[model samples]
Target: MTTNQAVSVAVADRRPLPHLLVFPFPAQGHLLPLLHLSTHLATRFAFSITVIITPKNLPLIQPFLSSSSQIHPLVLPLPPSSSLPSGAEHIRTLPDGTPSAALIHALSSLRPSILRWAKSQSNPPSALISDFFLGWCVNLAADLQISHVSFFSVSALLAAILHPLFLSLPPPSSTPVSVSPSLPSFPFPHLPSVFRRYVAGNPDWDFTRESFLSNSLSSAAIFDTFDFFDSHYLSHLRSSSYASGRLFAVGPIPPAVPESDNSNIFPYLDSCPPNSVVYICFGSQFTTEPALAAAISAGLESSGVRFVWAVGTAAPEEFNGKGKVVKGWVPQRAVLEHVAVAAFVTHCGWNSVLEGLVAGVLLLAWPMEADQFVNAKLLVEDAGVAVRICEGGPGKVPEAAELGRLIGEAVEEGSWPALRLKAAEMARKAKEAVAEGGSSFLAMEEMVKLLKQATTED
Candidate 1:
């Protein structure tokens, strides 16, 4: 048997495993990271894992399923119709065609279903891991007397910044702002521009109430970031009020661990000479307009960059001649690790950024919403790993010239190779964190122990 197999068998033969119920926030970005973490926990700890997902997202969650019966997929039913806003189905489209407020509410509204699922499980979970934003899970854990911890499905840097804000946003005033349709800008300036836009439009005026909800609700906060990437952020978290000795940092959870080789899938994938292809993909959630997609396609063609763009809803048909579009999903980790993938053009999702860094690939940041813009900023400003597309006319799509010039400059820039080398170094540190004596492994051990103690006290 292979060394990994031997280790797996030994782990299985050990004492009874813990039962873990992992509930991710009901979105693609949230689901994928939590799934990766759940898979790791199941394989390494021999734990029985139940992943809670919304019914709408079950199809996307299904393909990742393993043959191992130890892992279970549980779908939380949609809530009562009355709880939903009017024309909720159409809410995927805002009045001006952006993502709608109703969609956000619908995602957050899954608390009742998740709580019911947890309480109703036949084999009660030994521990609970939930998304940090899902504050209601803490309440459910308390009500059910189950040990619970929050999962921040992003980087150590992002989570560290967010943790303090969770506490910081709570108001100091006598009167509270009402949660309403009109969202106001976030209290903090550090939030990404897109998040700023959303908050500006959709006021949770309920910030103080939500902050209290979080403090009272979660037993601990867990981050999906490794220790090496952002020591300062992690340290900040440990010392803050958001600090619960309950925080856990366990990650570098690439889509595939040890990478099961699939050379036949993309035969050209390995054959391409080293550092030739620019790997382009926004995370799974981003869906853009035909105009933007076409513009990006024209740019890739103009740049003469051999690329594999993992086509999602945002990928346009116009690029058929310019590059290969692997519809559905592509093994991102494998692509990044492939020698030919010299650079990554991305939406700057935390997981994507981490994986690219882990693979030591240079980056092209095209942030959409949420913390992505800030992540792009950090990569360019803090990490020195990427460059942004140049701004264009107000409504004009990126011209072939703009795309060509940036890609050419980035490729020829002597700094890119240096940055790639640095990114690889970061990746090495990430791997070290999960090694047997690594910081992430030890953190998990400590977290598991804390959960056992907390549950016992409860």
Candidate 2:
């Protein structure tokens, strides 16, 4: 070959693999999904991923680190500040009733540290991919001259519903927004608690609101959802002026957790009959109020349904000898995958909701805060796989007797057969998405292709 040919080969071989600097908001619900995405970007598409974290969150990413070589950690200590308790690196560790805005405000201090780290690197990241909670990263990406993308841990249905608000439009009118003729629209009164609590010009409310609004200006946004849930919602957002043809739905990805020695727990799980167990958990952050826990136990006992409750705080002592009450870690995905678990009592956090969907278990949704309220709506009205028990947010305890009647009816043999079919069908659709030539598989390809393209053009 001529010298010119050799030079061409040398230059082409030196081209860098597209690198993404990912920042996961420090909550299990927020962090785990991004870790799954980071692993997907690395293993599935061969992109180099550098995830940002404070010191305490390293353990959370440990499972992913041991599995993939392409993803690296950029740990920066929080600069000394009295705003948050020391060693409170993630939201799950934050004291209950701490203002939601406090952590967001505290985290913004890391912007300078991240900026310095990126500058010191030899090959700058191709783009910055951050959780929607850290919407301010759009500016950080601008400073580094990299494309900015926000990853939403919520559903596309919620994203489309909130698009107007994200663009600074008026609150959705009390009339239900017509999402689809066949499915129920989340009327203004039924909208998420976060949106309902909006107080214009209030300092704390404005701060949180702007964090959400800043995401609309991102060059691109990713949703942890798939077309099977709502193609119309996905299409609407893609066509919206804010998204401008840059929205990717590559999800229903399962959370990563440690391997099971759940054999100890399975004796209880094993003793239950097929589709006879009700599995209850309220996500990572929300501690169950003691009275509410007792009320739930009362209801479960009244129904005479065998159950497994993963109450993070304290389990009700009254239900002793009747059910399994776990006060510590339970392998949620593993437990849900079991045949005995027929229904899930959940907070409807997107991650937990997706896990239940994939397991083909019915969701007994009790949305407390954040996007959970909207999630419950989509499951009950749109997806037809869930039944909402009560949703007044946290501290709105329901009457135990009424809750029991609902739970018993929901899981009774041969009840809601059509709903059960939908749940099972959703599970199959989830599997199909990962199969070759599926919608999500194709979307994943396009997302990676575009990310690489953006890197080259920049």
Candidate 3:
């Protein structure tokens, strides 16, 4: 038998394998990557996996559950809260696409429910792998006497940047703080919009800030970032948090695309020249303000580059030969992989960054909130694969002339080829990091060993 199979068989031989319980904060960017990672652990290690999901998010987990019986769902009804809009279990489904603060407040209510369920169980899970946003899971797992492995949906770079902030009392002020000698200090205002909004004495705000701080005390931490893309940051985080000594960098876990999928699937990409089309998408949670949207459309139109704009709303006037403007979703992974796609204009969300990196598509970054500004720094300054075209929220608009120039110049012959080449090199290392015997692969194996050890002691 092959090595992975042999490992799986040996793991399965230990009947009633150590159960892994997962809890994802309800957001598209956070949910999907953890699900993908959970599925990988199940298939490769033959471990039983149970996901803690709300009634509304159940549908999203169905396909992953259907394919693998090893993975199961533990549905928990979302307790009613005025803070959350009814039936809105995910940030993507929030009315008018609001950011996740309200949703985070609503999710904090589930802590008691989760605690009760675990306490009643005959076999409490060996480990509770939960989203970084739900840092209270560290305390929850402690209550159940299980390992709480904090799972960061953000880049390792962002997590490293947040470490100092988490330890600081009363959160960060307007001043900048140094995280690593290799990287620039981050001003508090640019850290995360939510952090600046914290009011120390308020219960909800204190709870939220406490949740962010609890990650440091986790039994272990895992980032959905592979070493190739965030090696320096990951190493810095490890050295800083060495007392925990169990940080894992095991991802950018390949997307769930079918292996047999083909380029002929997209006629526009199929027909376009190599390194020709520009791909534009901000994440689902972000909606461009109409004026900003109009400016972007005008810029794309003026640039004269072949492009694909998944604007979601406020579409540009289509010039038939120029490009296609989409109102909804596009298969991002497939689009990035296409030979015709030269560059991506993106929000620098961790998931989108990995997609662009793995495809070797250079970035034209428009980072808004959360850890995006820091992620933009990694791409623009540290890695040299992206150019920062714009920064700040939807209201922050740039001159159409400047925006068009940056977009046009991203693929222009000057420095574009070098950026693309470096991206390609990172992409190669990224794929290798997840393959057998790679840095990510070994880290995962070590995590599994720790998980199995947890159960044996039980």
What's the true lDDT of residue 215 in model 2? 80
Task: Please list all clashing residue pairs in model 1, or write none if there are none.
Answer: 182-203, 183-201, 183-202, 183-203, 184-199, 184-200
Ranking by lDDT: 3, 2, 1
For residues 368-428, write the lDDT of model 2, one tens digit per residue: 8777877887899888998888875446888988988888776688888888999999999
The better candidate by lDDT, 1 or 3, is 3
Q: Which ranking of candidates, highest TM-score first?
A: 3, 2, 1
Using lDDT as the measure, the top candidate is: 3
| Model 1 TM-score relative to the real fold | 0.78
All candidates' TM-scores? 0.78, 0.88, 0.91
Q: Residues 124-232, candidate 3: write the lDDT tens digits.
A: 6888999998887888888778888988888777777665655564456567866557657877667766565667676666777778878878988988788777888
RMSD per candidate (Å) reads 6.3, 4.6, 3.1
